[model samples]
Target: MIEKIGNAIKDKNKSAVLLLLACFIFVFILPAIEFTSNMLSIFLFSLIIFLASYPISRKVMFIGFVVILIELATRATDFIYVQYLAQLTTNLFIIFLVGSVIRHMMNQKNISIYTLVKALNGYLLLGIMFMSLVAFCDLYMPGSFNSSGNSDMELVYYTLITLTTAGYGDITPQLPLAQSLAMLIAVTGQFYVAVVVAILVGKYASKN
Candidate 1:
């Protein structure tokens, strides 16, 4: 059973599907439920890491597992130091995952549904990764963002809007670090879209 599961995860398209589904739930569904402990959020994050990391390497998968363990400890203890560790590990893992997805897409010779899904997954992961950074900034410096509360879901929402360059003005970044992060997120979002479209078009043209 373990081998079968590993083999299934090794399939890039299958893995991308699972990762995208997990991201969709974390981004869309979990916020509505709004659990106080954010237990569900972390669980989905761990699942995404597990799915996303397998396509890269077993080493990355193991590291992501360790990060998930740290996140679980953060939720259980709610210690500031553990939270810091969780934030760091989660941020690094997501960054690595995003890079791996982009690298994989770049190496693909044909543009298919898997390529499109990987692109989408990478985009969503970019948003979530920035969300982690935003949360880290808030944790390190309280009142970083002008939100009613510092919930993970609120950060996710703010990050998504900032990433899309929406500038809703409802949740503004107050601190220097937070404001810089918002700008970086917005720029990175635009850059990712531009690069991915170029890659896809190039691949399609080559195929034709």
Candidate 2:
């Protein structure tokens, strides 16, 4: 079983699949259930982070995991400045890790189903990273975002809507820095879809 887990970690596709599964559960399923204890959410998020980190660097992964533990340790405090700081730092690392994964996927000599999955994974991870940035900004400057910094689900929704350029206008950024970051997220999403996604689709079709 240990060897099998190691093999899965070494395979980008397997890691991507696991990440997607964890994300789907956390993003879609967990929100609907009314649970007073946050144990379920914590478990799902940790699982997602572990699986996503597996495909990147082990050292980076270890650091992220440590940051997560510290974040959890500080959760009970009345003042959570340190918790937000740790979250921001860990999320920045995650952004780099996901970018590395995307770079590796694009540098592949041949496209396959794994490549396609990795591409999708990159898209999802990119949105999540931007969401983390937005959350961090909100924590840094209270009322920077239209929504209260209370629910992860709301942040995920805002991130997806912003990435897709839907701009429902429900969660506008209040501060200048937040506005700039929002615009950057929108542009990055467009560029990714127009360039990277287009190239990947073309290559996949050519392979078939």
Candidate 3:
């Protein structure tokens, strides 16, 4: 079954379309299964992105990336409050993806120190923008992610502020899960900037 499905996706036949639709339904229709199914959706999404990038080149990956995000948001939306938030974040993500993808694609040059630094900066910017979207959805849009028994808004607020290193007092995460995620995002954000900047600076020095 897995092989067959993989082949279908590879072929881009009717089954692939059906599977994509099924993925959409599973991702959005079963909010009860959001965590479980989203795991699957996310896995497939990663492949879709890699395929999208490899086949069309990274230059075209942004469109697929943005489409996937919007599709997920559309499917997940149900409650009015959550739907509103989903709509907002989805739009922002699409815009960010377009700008990020275009800049990277347009600037592509033979891989070297200069290209490497720019690519890292590009990826880091993309990652943070994506994280921001997730934070927004997690906070404002209920059911976009499972709360596991906590205030969703608090999660959103904490995610955004923490990722930005804002450390706002109003939305400190008390739960172990939230705290862990907060720590992870903080590390990710800082490391991304540090590593990318260092690489670019190194490249600059070598060029001079």
Tens digits of per-residue lDDT for model 2 on 65-148? 887788777777777777777677778777877788778778887888877777777888787778678778877788888886
Candidate 2 TM-score, true structure as reference: 0.84
CA-lDDT, candidates in order: 0.82, 0.79, 0.50
Judged by TM-score relative to the true structure, which candidate is superior, 1 or 3? 1
* Clashing pairs in model 2, backbone N/Cα/C closer than 3 A: none
Q: Work out the TM-score per prediction.
A: 0.87, 0.84, 0.39
By TM-score, highest first, what's the ranking?
A: 1, 2, 3
C-alpha lDDT of residue 79 in model 2? 71
Per-residue alpha-carbon lDDT of model 3 for 85-150, expressed as tens digits?
A: 555755564455535543543344333543553444344334434444555545554444344535
Q: What TM-score does prediction 1 earn? A: 0.87
1 versus 2: better TM-score goes to: 1
Residue-pair clashes per prediction, in order, are 0, 0, 0
lDDT of 1 at 26: 86
